[model samples]
Target: MGNDNDIRHGRHCVFLMHVHLVFVTKYRREVFTKEIIDDLRDIFASVCSDFEAELVEFDGEDDHVHLLVNYPPKVAVSTLVNSLKGVSSRMIRKKSYPSIRRKLWGGALWSPSYFAGSCGGAPIELIRQYIEQQQTPH
Candidate 1:
C-alpha cells in the first residue's frame, strides 16, 4: 500500500512526492558486481541527504540501477540526477575497481540518458475527475 502519511512539511509548503529513477551503464556494459552495487546504494543515499531527499528503495542489475526517492518540491529533479551520477562516478572510479574501470571506457559511468517517473500516488484519472467537478468563477 502507498503511504497514507506521505505528506511532508517545509517552511512554507506541504507536499508529498516520490520518483522512480533509473540509470544505465555506459554502452550498456555489464560492470557491476554485488560489492559495487552495494557501494552505489550507499553513495546514492548519501547524495540524497545533501538534497534533503530520502532514498526509499534501490535495486539493479549488472548494467543499470533503479532508485525510489522521496523529494521536496523545491528540489530540481535534474540537479539531483546529475549530482548522483557525477558524484557516484567519481567515487566508484576512485576506488579503482578493475572490472568497472576496464569495462567503462571514456571515463563515464552512466549513459547520458536516464529514466524518471512519479510514483506511489493517486491515479491521474481520479485527479482529473475531481478537477472537472470543481466549481469555477465565470
Candidate 2:
C-alpha cells in the first residue's frame, strides 16, 4: 500500500501558458510602418527570449500592436511587459526610427502603459484562433 498524496505529488507539473499582450503608441499615433513593425518584432523577440519566453504571433497596425507569447511559470507579467516596452522604445528611438523622436517631441515611441492577459481558460484559445483565421481572403 502507498500514500495517495505522495503518489500525486510525484509527477512533474508543467503549465503550458499563453499570454496576449497589447502595446500602443503614445496617444495612438500612426508611427509604425511595415519597416518599423518588422524592426520592432525582431527587437521584441530578442528581448523576450532573455526572459525565458517565446514570442509566438505578432501583428499590429499604426497605433497598436498585438503579441501572443508563451512563457515559463517563473515569469511575472509586469516585468515582461516593462522590459519589452522599455527596451524596444529605447532601441526604436535611438537606432531604428529617429524620426519618432522628432515627431513626439520626446524619446517615447510607445505609451507608458500596456495590456496583458493570460490565455489559459475561457475563450482565449478561441480568440487567438479567430485572429489566425482572419488571414484568409473573404
Most lDDT-accurate candidate: 1
* RMSD from true fold, candidate 2: 12.2
Ten consecutive residues with minimal summed lDDT in candidate 1? 1-10
21-119, model 2: which lDDT tens digit per residue? 999998778878888889889999998899878898999998899999877768898899999999988888877464465467566777888888877
TM-score for candidate 2, please give it: 0.75
lDDT of each structure? Answer: 0.93, 0.79
lDDT of 2 at 67: 95
How displaced is residue 6 in candidate 1, in Å? 2.1
Instruction: Give a tens-digit lDDT track for model 1, residues 5-84.
Output: 77888999978899999999999999999999999999999999999999999999999999999999999999999999
Worst 10 residues of 2 by lDDT: 1-10
